[model samples]
Target: MKKITLLLLFPVLLIAQEKATTANTAQSGRYDTNKFSQMYDLLATPNMFRTASGAPGPAYYQQQADYKMDIELDDKNAKLHGSETVTYYNNSPDSLEYLWVQLDQNQMAKDSQTPLAESEKMEQTFPPSNFADKFLKKELERGFVIEHVKDAKGAPLSYTINHTMMRINLASPLKPGTSISFAIKWWYNINNYQTEGGRSGYELFEKEGNRLYVIAQFYPRMAVYNDVEGWQNMQFWGGGEFALPFGNFDVNITVPADHVMEATGELTNRSEVFTAAQLKRYELAQKTFDKPVIIVTQQEAEIAEKGFSDKKKTWKFSAKNVRDFGIATSRKFIYDAMAVQLNDKVVMAASVYPKEANPLWEETSTRTVAHTLKSYSAHTFDYPYPKAVSVSAADQGMEYPMICWNFGRPDENGNTSEQIKNAMIGVVIHEVGHNFFPMIVNSDERQWTWMDEGLNSFMEYMAEVELGTNFPSRRGPARKIVPYMSGDQKFLEPIMSNSEGIIQFGNNAYAKPATGLNILRETIMGRELFDHAFKVYANRWKFKHPTPEDFFRTMEDASGVDLDWFFRGWFYSTDVVDIGISNVKQYYVTETPTQELKNSRVKKGRFDLEKGPFVYLVEEDNKELRARDKKALKIEDVTLLAEYVATVSDTEKDAFKTPKYFYQVTYNKPGGMLMPILVAITYEDDTVENFKYPAQIWRKNNQNAVKVYATEKAIKKIQLDPELETADIDLTNNTWPKESLKSKFD
Candidate 1:
């Protein structure tokens, strides 16, 4: 690949790469800053619950929290009411006296502390709805009301509310293998996602007098209880997402009679909710593998939107082994679905959108959903759920169990650009691909956002590429993350940093990790090895909670590749790759050895200077400004070579390849991170040859690495990371005859 970068001409934007030195270089007592050091100090000690191999240990146990809920939508009042019975199972060995429940909705409460954590600034523009929600309206009547908290017998249970978390005081010590059940009732006003801003809420189609509700984190939920962190009771400060345990769900949601809804599970009352024509189309969708089947056509949806039904209908859904729940309900929804076959199983790719989403959504939504499931499945593991649904909502893209909400709206005039179309398709793929990551693999996003978002983004990149050729993906390329990784150090944070502490959330949490994995797959570890290990991890921890170490360990253990250097360099610290070829010297196969080689021979007592076979040659500086003969030197031209050849055995003669050319290449590492050295050797014939030197090349030498290349053909030019796969920050020093920069205007 040709070198292409705007930095070539823009010298002011470029800064000299600060060299990364080894810990051994320190004069006296010092901290261990070895980039290749084991992550023993940072990783938790392996125990019965989590093993060193990165797979779940023999005694691994995760608590389960089952939920049975009754939910209702008061569209007129813009409120959501819910009552739920949470059954906690003590799968862990330890007994518990209290359980923590997360009231995520509290982030939007009138007295929410979330607003105080952020530093806000005034923007230049706002729509009427934004202004109304900002000033004209009273404080949003947000957060859960907590109408009551009762035991299975309906007796009130003692519970205390502290910000977004609720502590349920147990009547007795819940012993191991035992279970307890309790109920809670709550209600709260839903925000308009476009105006108030949130992952989930309503999108108003004011002219049509209807609203589309895409809701999650709308009810009180149980927190995760595991061996790693007994109770993941991290406060929902808004930046940190949720941490929940996996269990079954039985929910009944009531919405207007004219509305169509999809939730986290299979709709049990499809017969009662769907019209005859809709039922027929759904059956066809199950068999339609080529394209989407329109379950609710735009005409029908438009007719239904006009009828604000006074009555309500209940949508019954049941799900198994899911960490969380979500629902999208609206009378203005145009529903479509298609069947996708994965191995022996069949899954549905579904979508729901309003007319405003038009032309764009209808063309790509469900297809992108299908493509994502297939791509993620092929890369990771099979899609475990029965269906993956995409719901269209403006300005929001959030994932749930089997469903997620996406944003991609064309203009009111139904006009869309290539950018808009591609973005919408990419968002749908990303949101739907989340199912394979945190949804099934079950990583705690509240503690480490990259564990989910970053991994999902990487998978999303693959899926988007698999979806089409030359796709304009925003992440997962090693070179794409160079700007952020090489930017101001103070403004950057390591990929392992906590969710709320990150300075560049998107670049740090999503792009960096994705690019790191890409580097591992494409450059460090070959695809076959990397893919097998990645799939092993997904299969090992499916439906279980996995920590960052679990993923790190599994990847190494399964691939039989030691990635301590990579994980430590890329994740634990903010490091940039800046390896380049500083110089290259060519040597002829003369019997006269260089002074450095003669010194090594003297040390071994092999310097026979008084022997009859003495051959001496003079040296010439390569700075003579002349090119050399492009052919191998004949053994007859140098008497010492003929004498040596006659003395060596025929077997050794073949190995010598006499009269060969040798080039000593010097590579200097100025960046903090170490990467596999990829050298592209351009021969005099203009034929390009590439060789990769593993990152271990720098193990003995902390700074500069020297490797001698012997070839039958003369070399023309030498370059490092010719394909830009290592995310090297400096390209100026990469070539042997260092490449010069020229402005385009010149």
Candidate 2:
């Protein structure tokens, strides 16, 4: 009761302290420092391009860049040559003088400046191969070698090459409704992915003398032009990924005659390229749903890889409204496909892997792809593409529009550990799930990695659960992120940080945001509300670029919840949650008012007790020293109690038994973050009572929140956050009358 009375007087004390601090500091500008205040200043100003409701406004516009490419892969030389025709359409309000093209392959150039960004140094421990590649191995002739740039009229067009980006000088200003067309020719050497470690490269099977190529960013592509940033000209720094415009693609790829190929778009020349036997299997696969139909079997692939073909064949593909394109080709591939139904649409889920990937890839790859599409489509939108492909590439997981490369290979005997199986399933779901994120919903990964990786990872977590029973997902649990959130604060950054500058990129971009969204779904907003709101954001931004502010606004706008406090604490600051029960005490009825509470209430005239004659409360404890004081005046001797008892009629005496117990509990937050207080009260009878105080409980008092309970049964213990739903960092102080911690050694 002593602690409770003084806590009631905190307002006067805070005012006095604030005045003293204000006078000493001489700082006068007023600001909304309250955690529950609306964060209007921190948000971008709403405009016609992006509305306050998080949907695209009436005047919103996005630029489009269509491509027609002829690409050839030289197997012996390990080089790629391409000639592309790009048509740029200006859908924006402003006219453009020049167009920016992305030369992403230049990142592998010998003169690439990417390494200078990190000022990399040799580590203490390294593999012999990595050491050799760093110090002894000669630099390869990689990156694009531009031969010519020609306009639509066959005249040479002037262009400037800057490391990973090219600026095409237009003959005249391209108006809002006009379009421009140009052509470019280039070639570059590909890297060995296993030893080099990158997004796209060739994996050499030395034992068989064959190579599997997974290619992306192979051509000079167009950069994004939008209303928000005008021109997203950020260079390809390897860490920060791409920001591109959406358009149609028509590509023709030339490869060895026996090679099997899978790419981002539908294969228009499949009948012309596939054998008569293969064509029959492919048609059956389109109607198959339960299991995959194998087009190229292991026995056939084994014979094809033994000898190289002298002639070449060109495979043609066509895609509509896709942001990017990718291709995977190898003579050693075993191909399979199955149909997946999403509402009325049936998408082809396909896989391409060598015999080395069995039985892991053969057992799970295509199935995982089907499950991810269903789970994500249930939450976001339907899969818009004709097909999605997953290819086996060791030591890498990278996603393009409809095609992605993953790592999953068994030992020589075709057996795998539980760890490898789970890893394979999780990575497949994550990469294939990317099709729903930046591939279709289209966020700028170069600027905000979390919008794609984080959102996709969250959806991936859900898909993993639907794909397998008791799946071992790596993220999306509140408790799993505690270690990273509680780690050295100097190395952590806010989730809104720039992609390249982010510290602990995986946890910051992939895990932390996923965990926060899970908390919102499970604890804050509940599943029904969070699900509907999340779906709204997906439907609004599909095939368009969305920013961080758009997501923040859409969530609150759809959920009918003021989540400014959450966004401010979790996304804007490096704050951790640490809420606990500070203290608990029991009290009894008293005839006279305690001097402390009397002083606070009488002076302020603010006491508003529900029960009558609630003058005071005296704390009680079982101590020898308090025996005399307890015997001096029993609670029955209090005149107020006796008078109330006498006034009650005999018939109502049973109906109104006097309250025998009163307990006051106080909760305190040591960390900077604010969260709802979840409490569980245990009684001597072993029954428990659960109570939840919404996050607004701290609106008036940010440091401490107090509650009073009157119960018939005595409470044995009180615990805060019994389920650990808020990602609280410290658990040692979570219980009042704290028990001794017991570890395994104990």
Candidate 3:
């Protein structure tokens, strides 16, 4: 009887196998040609200046610009004036005919093109103050006023000004491997930053009749000159930030004797600037790692605010190898400082805020700075600078070299909300983390904002999470960016867009790329590989400018993985991820040739009814033949199968695992993005098994992919992306037995 069954099934099996082989071989030449190709066209070709290995090659060179400035702030007049002497070094391989300086404050000029470039629309409702500022108030005569341009000999030099940029023509061409010295004296009216939103300026306290100044981009600066874009003298449009060269700064700032100030560098004359008690506290702060020491008490600040000292004090600072300079000064600032150990270095974490900022800023600001440095250093490189300062300025969040201004103030009654507290902490971390990014790594912010802002934001999220589980981080999660990514493509811009061209600045320049890196760390590359590669990038580009290619190549080079597809999909395109299980089928194996197999054989005309070893059941037609076949094929009468089982070894019998169930699951990609497929299968025995398919599974057929599973238990249900790891736009089709949806009317 066993022989009869085997003989009857042979012909049908052979015919099915032949048909499958023929179908598979029919479309031999039709294949996806770009499944695993390198990103040659999309990437810049590797050259001597910047190698394909993502490191600066032997011939790589960068220009340098150093500055010595004397600045004065007229608190009563709300104005700032500076006279800077710049010593420019031509380190590049090309000769320099002239030097370009960036007047970033010119964007606020009354006749500046920045305001004209903005398209205003009449809204249905507007705030009274906003309406007045927009329609009724006269434009302020803002921007830089250059007094004179002179050479080292004090003789006037030829200069030209085109809006925000100034060209200083040298008497003789500044040859390669040479240095030139020039001087510029300029001043500009400081705008009311609270009324006019900008990266720098002063915010007034109407009740106190005083001002708190948070200043940056306040002086004429040299633009970046590198292999990518020689002399990146891009206009300082209001949205996109500056692109300055790394240099040492010796700045002398003059302010009221009673006012406290914090700048980019260490104070050269701490003894002359601080009182005896404040100096004692400042000394103690260097050893106080666990908590902060108050340098200037709130009572002292309040008393100083009322003095309005006529005498001026010179607070000298000297910073080394920094991109730009910034200062925050006000008599109302209550100063605090603490020490944090980052690896082997003990760095100061400090904050300068008004009494209104406590007890929130007092508790969190400096702590956030310290935490940011630790978290960022753990993932990238250590904090190379001596100090990180956070100054509380209303409606301000901006980062310079070692100092940054943050916004988070309590109500007039010293009351604060959880949201406000989190915002303060989040912004502080973000700004301090920037010290590791463009401040040190020194990427070109004018050309690629993401290279600085996006990376810093990603580091900020990590620091926030390290703060605690419940920390309210605004970005860095895969799911947090889905709303923006899956929104109307018309309003959405790719992450690779220019800083000025992005529609949603915060979401595009900060959140999306950060989220992409978070996804890379948590899902695609895993934390170990991603962190190592990220550290390599941070160290490799420290104090040097790196383009997008340097970051992309270094990540792959360090991780030994090809990530071109990831970069292309996440950065270069506005594609959303939506992978789902389209269909699922389950089958069980049987020894007998069932009616389906018999019909397949009959259709192909490959089986005969009288063939030897024939097996049949009473369920089919022809009652007489069915009865005879069933009687001959009865289990007890199968002597050939019994003999074979008796002859088989126990070990061989144990090795056989006849799978009880087989599943063919098909995954469909409704969205035009590629991601790994994560599946979880639940069986009848209440057990679960997870399967992870690499992103390459969809390389051949991007729209749909099928995977087969052989299991011991019957599959009850299948779930895709069970952990919500992927940013799948749609969840409706992500289950084998589709989830039921009810209509709104129902």
Candidate 4:
């Protein structure tokens, strides 16, 4: 995912090698030179308007909320019914006049103001969100605004719906630092998140004449309270994900008697809900440390699918601290669980897909989830949840903590593309990685989208790479970013922009940031440093609100590298990397008399004269090579020297030292982004040498920087970061003795 921010300047500090006595201090200073001041300024900007203390402050703070929900899915009517009791802890010092609840599903209502506005603008070329049509047709829509405001004691309280937000007017102001418990009963239509074109909901995957359920965002929940926005009023406009308050939930979902289900939390009443065989199998799965033990078999699913029993079975789940809850259930759902040993505990890596997902999702999805848990844990934090689920759906892949929806399907003849397989694996990894980014490492995504999408996408790339060589990572590879970086600058954005307003949508906001972080990890700071810092950030801010500054600061702080420049150049500005080897000059040392050297070669003469000053006689005492088999020296070996310095006294010999060759190679940074210059220089004797100059070399002069190499062998060729990665954007300048352009078409 690209993280597009507005352009901003960063301070640059260059370090000279001679001045720094300590290597550690010098390296730290060099890395810190390019710090992102813009992020700090933006985050620190005070807002007084929403201040509860009558002073400047952040607008809202998400309270730790707990919910006890009793829900029933009326599949026959395509409706969802739920009544949840929410306990909201007021951490803010100020008292709340009212609390707002987000009715996300309302956006799908036919009469919604957004859809109405969108419908008027819709032409044949532009289609409505996939969930829009499904919401209006296949899903039942009712109780458009069926909610009652209540106090902690269950007494009625005044409430108002100002468009998308339902404001509950408390009977009396809930004082500062207080907890408010209330209940709201709500039900909504169920539609696939990506049916016609929408982003969340359920898709009906048929297997053995049974339809499997893949559900998401089926109910209304609370909006986020943050520093920037008091309450996020941004409507679920289809593609973008959600921003919510962290809380606990006790959800009870009831479906048909025979239907099996899996959701966001553990099944609290498994004994009451599952059959004797399921209980025994569940116990076995707990010990099955390797592969998944099937809880619901295909034959049982087919039998259940034959009759859509109206009898509802309640499956209770209680999550201690969670932001949201989602579930997938169906008689045709094929469920499997594999034990993933994280740290010492065993977390279940599960998958729920139809027979269509067979040969693909059935085999790889769970394993990919396992991989995500492992790789991401190594980089960020451990898999704390008991289970991580991957459910097969169509359209865009979305992530939620411990639960994610994936997209992949086989051909009519059961043939699937390697592309599809890799894509599924990658998507699953990307989604599950989200459990770390916005979910546990809770960030205000609406305000700073990059914090969630960009960071998750970055880890997504790393996780994918760890998965295998052919893991088809679409967003994280640096080389894959060139096209987007080189695109029309007018249509681009820096990764620091507001989520909704960024240009170039997907690539600019999501993929670029991911690639930028990858470049920083691989080519800039390296894996060891980057991973440690990233993990620190994740662990430090888990379940709390973190801004972009928190992330930038924590990474640099933990890594002990001043990454200001990296954040500034990559996140705040639309800078492209286009560095090249501008020039290379070679020189040789000679020892001869001044006059003869100057006269023999004017270009050679001056060289001869310079050599003459340091000339030493083949001493009479040096008689070691006087053997009969020894060949005589040529004039070139004992050249006729310039005579100017031929008469050196004994005292001059005491001051004389052997001359060394020097070559100055100049490099140009056509790209605004500064990176370490990794240059490979080939010598005349078919030998290669590498010279590294820290990024600070360009701090003093961003135009062209020159480096002098003192070597015995003459440089034959030179190349810079030959792999064509680093998101260089332009490789034309990447080599000395410019490579000849070849026409592939010809």
Q: Please give, for residues 1-746, the per-residue lDDT of candidate 2 as tens digits.
A: 11122213121211212236455676569966899988787888889999998999899999899999999999988899999999999999998998999999898887888877777665988789778888898887778999999999889999998999999988888999889889999998888877775689999999877999999999999999998888898888899899989999999999999999999899999998899999999999999999888998999889999979978999999999999999999999999999999999999999999999987887789988988888999999899999999999989899998999998789889999999989999899999999988999899999999999999989988887776599888999788899999999999999999898987999999999998899899889999999999999999999999998899999999999989999999988989999988888776555444444444444434443323345355566533223333322343576555655666678876786455567889899998898999999998898999998989999998999998887778788898888988999988888877976677498
> Candidate 1, after superposition: displacement of residue 472 in Å?
1.1
TM-score of 1: 0.92
With candidate 3 superimposed using the best TM-score fit, by how many Å does residue 683's alpha carbon deviate from the native?
2.1
TM-score of each: 0.92, 0.92, 0.90, 0.81
State how far residue 344 of model 1 sits from its true place (Å): 1.0
- Candidate 2 structure, TM-score to reference: 0.92
Give one digit per residue, the lDDT tens place, for model 1 in 1-746.
32211101110112345565776676667897666778898888998889999999999999999999999999999899999999999999999999999999998888889999899999779898778777698776788898999999999999999999999998888999999999999999998888788889998887777999999998899999999879999899989788889999999999999999999999998999999999999999999999999999999999999999999999999999999999999999999999999999999999999989988888889999999988899988889899999999888889999999998889989999889888898889989988888999999999999999999999988887776578999999888999898899999998999999998999999999999999898888999999999999999999999999999999999999999999998998887899988777665434444454344333333334333244332223423212332235676666765655677677877887543566667899999799989989998889998998999999877689988776768889888888889989878888878778565587
Kindly list the per-residue Cα lDDT of model 3 for residues 205-299, writing each as its tens digit.
88878899999989999988888878888887888787888889999999999899999998999999999999999999999999989999999
Number of the candidate with higher lDDT, 1 or 3:
1
To one decimal, what is the Cα RMSD in angstroms of model 2 from the true structure?
4.4
Error of 4 at 206 (Å): 7.6
For model 2, give the 10-residue run with minimal summed lDDT: 1-10
Looking at model 2, residue 432 earns an lDDT score of 96
Tens-place lDDT digits, model 4, residues 1-746? 32221110101111223555776763523433433333444444434322211122354455777778788888876677777777777777567777778776666665567555442433444356544563456544522446565666778867776555677877778776888788786666666444434556556644544455665666557777655556676765544567788887778888888788888888888998778997888788777866677876766766777787868798887776677777878776677777878787788888877666676766688778888889988887787788888888766587776788888878777788998888888788888888888888877765677888888888888887776676667888878888888999888888888766776777866798888788778877888998888877788777777777667777777788877777788888888888888876543322322232234333333233343234322211223323321222222343333232244566865675432345667899888887778888887787887767777788778878987665655567788877755788777777777886465575
Candidate 4 TM-score, true structure as reference: 0.81
Scored by Cα lDDT, where does model 2 land? Answer: 0.87
User: TM-score of model 3 relative to the true fold?
Assistant: 0.90
